[model samples]
Target: MYENCLKGHSALVTGSARRLGRAVALELARAGADVIIHCNSSKAEAEAVKKEAIALGVDATVLSADFSVDGGAEGLIEAAFEVAPDLNLLVNSASVFPSNRLAEVTLGDINSNVLVNAWAPFVLSRSFAARAKSGSIVNMLDSRITDFDHSHAAYHMSKHMLALLTRLSAMEFAPSVAVNGVAPGLVLPPVDMDAKGGAADAQYLAGMASGLPLKKHGEPEDVAKAVLFLLASSFITGQIIYVDGGRHIRGGE
Candidate 1:
């Protein structure tokens, strides 16, 4: 709702091709910031988002990166810097949500979860700090990190690691880069559910919302608003704003 709040800033938002990442990038663009959109395999989708951002009267571009590959995060940072030479904001939003219980989790699952969710964000944060005069980072996290999710053992663990990095990086990058996170809960449909009309998924979400204190789910825009707040704040750091519709206050997930 703020106007031209980020007039002089530029941002690179990973996974900006769709969903929550797209929302965050657009939110920043609406606030008057040039955006560098990043996606791994969604070039066409990313281009669409870039057009929308450009329509907001801000410079926008797209970059592709595979965070699961070696040196991928570094390559993303380098390529982004080449485009936005004065980049001052980073949104680490690219993530994979694979469902696997503890006994069912494979080494491949663990590595992928850690690489994309935690390791990639850390690498980008470090790289951003080394070059920026002043910046802010908003890591997309899960509210499940506060309690636990047995259904996604590896994914939960990786998000827990990301939450810790949010705090630690704020300290390490002190006075230069402010690190924060936005923990979302029951926001959007999962990838598999997105393509087809998810009647069953809608029913599941309706049932799940009953357990939450607010008795409702959230939207991608809610998480975007949280990211925008952290980006605009100069005094807030090392904190996570849970945009979970009060679900996090429940005893356990």
Candidate 2:
């Protein structure tokens, strides 16, 4: 269904090295968008994703920047424009998820989390609005932002900030650019987990999924598809699609 939906469009997907970001990049390529794959320290993996997108017949290249560093977001945007001047789409998917409770979280933890997770996206969105004559942006958010995540306090706070930015940006960049977000629930395993999906982590995720309305989990492509839907639409703006299997609304029950 996504075939050629984004013809003539060019996108820069942050964190495209692996996981959900990788999935979104591939899906965009399948839909016929030239893509710029951004990675921090995953250049090798990003190269692989670039190859995959090129194999799909889309112009693909890899850009690297550490979002945790100052000016990283701005630098990446400048570099992307240098590579794809017609670039009109931005996917702010790169984020840091350091686990710590609010009571125990350090100031450094808060700074790092907010800088990478929230500030970076904010900068990218601003840069895109200024450069891209017209296009759209998809910010990757978390379903947990609707509530609290005591176990990941700083990360949760940053996501809340990003959610607010999504709405404000949609309003700020309206008519010229559409800004939206996708909040995914139990999709892929945590980045810290074993790449091969260990049994213990599988059981843990299963237990978590059992309580969701869907009583199951989702895949990275599920979130990627929702992103593509937003990117392909002309009327959607300032909206957050919960690709969370009803987890965000579970409290209502």
lDDT to native, each model: 0.91, 0.92
Which residues of candidate 2, in runs, are more than 4 Å off?
194-201
> Evaluated with lDDT, which candidate comes out highest?
2
The alpha-carbon RMSD values of the candidates against the true structure, listed in the order shown, are 1.5, 1.7
Worst-scoring 10-residue span by lDDT in model 1: 189-198
Q: Estimate each model's TM-score.
A: 0.96, 0.96
| Model 1 alpha-carbon miss at residue 14, Å | 0.5
Worst 10 residues of 2 by lDDT: 192-201
Cα lDDT of model 2 by residue, 1-253, tens digit: 6689999999999999999999999999999999999999999999999999999999999999998888899999999999999999999999988779888989899899999999999999998999899999999999998877778989998999999999999999998999999999988777755656678767877887898999998989999999999999999999999998889999422
Candidate 1's displacement at residue 201, Å, is 4.7
**Which residue pairs in candidate 1 collide?**
none
Error of 1 at 47 (Å): 0.7
Candidate 1 residue-wise lDDT, 1-253, digit = tens = 5689899899999999998999999999999999999999999999999999999999999999999999999999999899989999999999988888999988999999999999999999999999999899999998898787888899989999999999999999999899999999878766645435467767777877888899998888988988998999999999999998887798455
